[model samples]
Target: MVSAWVVTKVAYVVISIAAGLIFFYVTSPLVKSEKKQPLEESVSLLINFVLYIWVGKILLNIDVFITDPLAILAYPSDSDAFYAATLLLFGNVIYKVKWKGLNIGTIMSSLAPVFLGSAFVYEFIEVVMNDSTLAWGHLGLLFLLLLFFLIFHERQSSVATAGGIFTAWSLGQLILTFYLPYTTLYGYMMTRWFLVLVFILSMTNLIQNKRLRS
Candidate 1:
C-alpha cells in the first residue's frame, strides 16, 4: 500500500511530465513528422533514466531492501543516487549513439524543451503549493532559459541550440548555488562540482558542433 506522500510525489511527477510534453508540442519549431522520432526517442530515454534512478536508489539502500523491500518504495532518493543514475544514463546514451546510430544532437534537441517545461512546472508547484521560497530562484532561471531558447532555437541548428540551452542552464545553476542555500535538480541537491562538469561538457559539445559546421 502506497502512502499518501508517495502518491502525491507520483502525481507531481506525472503532472510535470504531461505539462512538458504539451509545452514541447506547442512550442517546438519542427514540423509534425520531423518531431515524431525525436519525441519518441526522448520519452523512451527518459523512462530508462527514471528506471536507472530507481535502481540506483535500491542499490544505495540495499540493507533496507533486504530487511523490508516494500519500505524501499517510501525511501527518498538522495543526490548520490541521482549522480550515479546520471552516469548510467550517460553511458546508455553513449552506447546508443555508438552502436545504434542515434544522433546525440537530435536527442538533446528534443530533450531541451521538455526538460525546461518540466523543471519550470515542478519549481512553480514547489513555490506555490509547497510555499518554498527557495524554489523561486530556480523558477526564475528556468523562465530565462525558456525565453532564450525560444528566441534562438529557430535561428540555429538543433545541436547548437541544445548545446546553448544546456550551457546556459548549467552556468545559471552554478551561479545560483552561491546565492541560494543549495541548488537542486528535480528536488535532489546538485553539487557545484557536478555543475562545473556539466558546464564544461556542454561547452565542449557546443564548440565541437561549431567546428564541424566550420
Candidate 2:
C-alpha cells in the first residue's frame, strides 16, 4: 500500500509530466512563428526570469541564514508569480499555440482547482486533525503560493506553464503545510526542479516544432 506522502509525491510527478507535454503541444504553433528573436532566446528569457523568482527564496531559507518575511515571500511569490509571467509570454509575446490536444486541455483544466483546493484543504486538515503543529503564517504562505497563479504569462506555453506552475506551487504548498520535523526546504527544491523541467520542455518543443516547420 502506498503511503499518503508517497501518493502525493507520485501525483506531483505525474502532474509534472502532463504539464510538460501539454505545454509542448500547445506552444507548437508559436515555435514555428516568423519572429525576429531566436526561439531559444525567447524561451531562455522566460527561463531566466523564472529562475530569478526563486534564487532569493531558496538561499534565505537556509538554516545558516535567517530571512525577513518579505524576503521569504520573495521566493515563494516568484514561484507563484511565474504563472502570471507565462500568461504575458503567451498572450502578448507569442501569437500562436496549438490548443487542440486533449492532454493539454485536460491538464489546463485540472490545474487551478487542484492547487487552490489544496490550499483550503490543507487548512481544513490542520484545523480538523490534531496532527498539525505548523504556524498560521506558514500555512498562510502556502495559501498565497497556491493562489499566486491567478493570471499567468498567457502565451502558447501558458497551457503547459500554467499547469506546470500550479503543480510546482501546489507541491510547495503541500510540503509547507505538513508539520515536518526538519528540512523544510524540500518543497522549494521540488518546486524549482519541476519549474525548470517544464521550461526546458517548452523550449525543446519550440525548437522541434520550428525545425519541422522549416
Candidate 3:
C-alpha cells in the first residue's frame, strides 16, 4: 500500500512537469524568434537550481542517504535543501555575470514571466495538497500582482520590469508567510530573505548601469 505521502510526492512531480511544459509552450515563440541563447541559458540555470536542491537534500541526509541513496529522491524534500540550492544558484549567477560576461538583468527578465507561471502552478498544487486556504489566497493575489506589473510596466527596460516583479513577489510572499500560524520554517524564511537581497542588488545594478550610460 502506497502511503498518502508517496501519492502526494508523485502528484508534485506531475504538477511540476506540467508547469514546465506550460512555460515552454508559452515561450516557444520567443525561443524561436528572439534571444534564443539567452532564453536557453536562463532555462539551464533553472534546471541547475533544481538539481542543486536535490543534490543538497541527499548530502544533508547522507546518513540515511548512504543506506538507501534513492530514498532521498523519493521522500519529501526539506527546507535545508532549498537554502543550499538558493545559495548555489546565487553563486552560479554571480559567476556567470562577472566572470562569464552574462547580462544578468536581461536574462532574469526574460525568464521572469516563466518563473511566475511555474510559481503559480506549484503553489496551486500546494494549496490542493495541503488544503490551505491561506496558501491559495496568497497565490491568487500574487498572480494578480505579477500580471499587473508585467502589463503596466511593459514599456520599461527588461531589467527594471523584472526587478520590479521580482521584488513585488518576494515582498508579497514575506507578508503572506507572516500571516501563517507556523513561521518557524528556517529554509523558507531564508529563501524569502535571499530574494529580498537579490531584489536590492538588482536595483542597485540597474541604477549603476543607468549612471554609466548617462
Model 3 has how many clashing residue pairs?
A: 0
In candidate 3, what are the lDDT values of residues 79-181, reduced to their tens digit?
Answer: 7887788788889988988999988765676666666666677667767767756566457755786666547554666666666666666666566666665
Clashes of 1: 0
Cα miss at 2, model 3 (Å)? 7.9
Q: What is the overall TM-score of model 3 with all chains considered together?
A: 0.77
lDDT of 1 by residue, 84-194 (tens): 899999999999999999989888888888899998998898888899889999999999999988888888896898899899999999999999999888788999999
Count of clashes in candidate 2 = 13
Model 2's TM-score against the true structure: 0.30
Candidate 2 Cα errors over 4 Å, as ranges: 1-101, 135-138, 151-161, 167-214
How many pairs of residues collide in each model?
A: 0, 13, 0
Between 2 and 3, whose lDDT is larger? 3
Is 1 or 3 the stronger prediction by TM-score?
1
Candidate 3 lDDT score at position 53? 80
When sorted by TM-score, best at the front, the candidate numbers are 1, 3, 2
Q: Write the per-residue lDDT of candidate 2 for residues 82-105, one digit (tens) a residue.
A: 444444444433333354322333
| Model 2: how far residue 96 lies from native, Å | 24
